[model samples]
Target: MQFTTRPTLSGTFGMVSSTHWLASQSAMAVLEDGGNAYDAAVAGAFVLHVVEPHLNGPAGEVPILLAPADGEVRVLCGQGVAPAGATVAHYKGLGLDLVPGTGPLAAAVPGAFDAWLLLLRDHGTKSLADVLKYAIGYAEHGHAPVERVGETVETVRELFETEWTSSAEIYLPDGHPPRPGELLRNPALAATWQRLLAETAGAGDREAEIDAAREVWRSGFIAEALVRQAGRPTLDTSGERHTGTLTAADLAGWSAHYEAPATYDWNGWTLCKAGPWSQGPVLLQQLALLPPELPAQGSADYVHLLVEGCKLAMADREAWYGDADGADRVPLDDLLSPEYNAQRRRLVGDKASFELRPGAPGGRTPRLSAHALVAAVEGEGLDALG
Candidate 1:
């Protein structure tokens, strides 16, 4: 459950794994040279693409939560949007559901690279070279493979295998993945990194850097591979996504919004997290239902409540949650408040609470900020009788 990273390189840092470690190192190097946290963060993320390919790549999305030293937290949404005319109806019309690799469909505008460079110019004390030094070194000389990374490579080898004849020269040779400790390296990636590392902006237009990074991404053989899956000949986009409008145009025309996340107070703790645009508020809503003193950490009652709460949360999320930007105004705040949670918890039977829920209650509102601890009034905890 402890999914976090802390690097010796600088200020209170965290990453998911070792590639994230390299990214952190690159950023920390910037921070050590007097750069701010944002500078370090950007440097780290940009490098993760090459180091963590199956997950992150230039075509991949980037979303972040940042709290500056003296400012309120802000979100930068780098998740790419489908093209100007992309409709879910169209997807259904085509019946194309198979997802390709770190590819065109998953592509959003390559904003992180540009955003990172911009962050550096505004907050970093070091030069761009200083920020990218570690990334360049790793791309060329290679670094230690992170745990499960090689396993992931092996798992997905068949999906990306091409019949282009020279394609084996590009990826796996003889249809097998590179083994662990075999030095995962990419010279194409190195050349791309060198371009960004060496470029000098005329007026510090960081968007240009994002453009360059995305351009670098377009050169890769995988970038344009959607053609292989195209079922229709004239529609331009086959079943696979082509390197289409997820471009510098999209990046240049884009603007990210900063929104406040939701929080809940439960069991004498204030739980802070994202909104119902994801499953974040769902967890909060479930917790808000139980009495303030539901066991301490992991008693029997605690385990039962946690499992039951998770089930309730999942049901609600499925029924209500969707994109905050595009869908009906979701009742995320009201959903997470104590009133609705309390009402929903009623669905759980006092004796067992292990069975059926027809549906959630309606028109509830948060009423109590502080409540008396109502843990166990009569019997021993965790008994079916109680």
Candidate 2:
């Protein structure tokens, strides 16, 4: 018998799981209302944007993996690409070595909007109105704010008040963060979605309506708002106000597409993950380096080995993995090969290793990013000063 802390759940019909109860309930409601898994996922994701605003939002990216009952498992590449103007030269000219962690400069094309619609267009069996109703209701009407939402608001309260007044208007009600369980609403976000739905009117069928909504998001009012904001100067983590280089063309140029998932067979199971552009491939590489027979879960030996395997894989991720569009990209085929992993696995030893060791895949030398090299040089300088 397998022992576990949580009760083993079993079900036959359908199930939905999410970080927030509201999101799960919204998905389950869709499932109960005869929507398929894809429909339920889209509904759930939108609710997460509303309820877990501290964590996820419409501007964020999504990498989706789905297996249709009649089809093979595939990955939907929802991760947005950087704007054309977001070049190394642009940032270098701006006197910045790294992109600010906050502000419009850090944003990619808002892929979550089109990606969710794309999934619904291709795989889902519901109308756009049907999927968005739950999120719209939550955003327009008040919903109890999560504890973390309040905490996140408090953390950024000073910044909101001083730098981002638009955010302050939405998050800070009555000039303060809402206490836990207090009802919070975002009428602006609700209006955005409502306008999207309104724009889809007169589109032929459900598929056409979804496509129309996609266009509205990319080139219509949504794009207008984003480009307007991008052109404005905003305070960032760099402690300087910088206007974004992203344009309306940048938002219009990008769209989410599907691609084959990278897979690794372990024991009797095949695991699928998004490709090199994401941190997902690191998980596959870690599995390849780890022993086939792992020690029991939660054991000290298991933890040690897992940590050791991860260090080697993470180092390679820092050095090799990047956007697949360019000529220079991840050597994924060679990295995942049995021969390559066998050679790399030998480096994981009993002791914890602090050195960053990126592997030479296909005998090609690994090149660390300029940012990584700079960080290393800075660390050495600090050490010398100490």
Candidate 3:
């Protein structure tokens, strides 16, 4: 078996691993300071916003799964909903068939801030000030910038300069991307957090303090800034610049909530994942359809089987998955049933199938998105196996 270059370290206290080393350190600091897992996660997440802005930002959304030491596993629905003005009709009015991958039109209600705060307030043992200290410090005093951050900034330098001037002001210092290992400061974001912190001064208790911070984030300068900037056109991948529809009212109206996880039992291990609204259930369904016994890891057969299984699962996802509360929601119960999986398992063959096969549940017809249909048409004859 192949071994990792760095061996796993055993610890009785705790362990925190993130995409960035500084984020891991920030979480570890929380743990060392006697904070619980939720507190540590919140701290790490905020640090990630400052240090890995290229990957994720404060305005981005995140789907979190939290498993407490004694409590049941829960899903924190941090994936923000579309703003009130964001509708199929609205995008079509803009002459857009698809939402542009970047810029204003692509923005959703910023959920990460509220979600993290909710987790901290409800489950954490520490105060908001304590959890946020590391993030604020890093953003204010500066941290060593990663190579990828610099590379992404450099790649988008022209776009920033020409259209996204606000972005250029933050990313390009002295008209150039900051070099890797250089100290990078985001005083604006740091000040934003600090202002939120300042709002907690006269609160009654820890919970109240957190609540005050959430209110500030939703209705204060952050919301005002988003509302102002979203009204202006920005460049996007669709080769067109567009303005956003998100409003301050949208931010004020939204809050993160917890929900039960979708679970499936396989070989005495129960796997839990977010609902069909996410791609999580597709993974569970794929695992359910796999053979009880499998070939050796890293073997060609093993890789081929995994890939084929993924394709089959993804086809169903494209056809059936949508908002859980919607009329056309996936029938997850029937999809995961033993009888249904047994029937589906029979379709897996020695050779991979190029066809898209989506199972029908209780005679309900699958709903495929327009994007999927276009891809299916354009992807013909491009199949690697052919």
- Compared with the true structure, all predictions reach lDDT values of 0.54, 0.86, 0.84
lDDT of 3 by residue, 179-222 (tens): 77788998888888888888777786999999988888789877
Instruction: Report the lDDT tens digits of candidate 1 across residue range 181-206.
Output: 66766666676567654544442455
Q: Which stretches of candidate 3 lie over 4 Å from their true place?
A: 380-386
RMSD of 2: 3.0
Which residues of candidate 1, in runs, are more than 4 Å off?
1-20, 96-127, 163-175, 197-200, 205-252, 266-271, 349-386
- True lDDT of residue 115, candidate 2: 85
Tens-place lDDT per residue, model 2, 242-329, is 8897798988889999888889988889999988888888888888887677898888889988898897788788778887474146
Q: Provide the lowest-lDDT 10-residue window in model 2.
A: 377-386
RMSD of each: 9.2, 3.0, 2.7
Runs off by more than 4 Å, candidate 2 = 1-5, 374-386
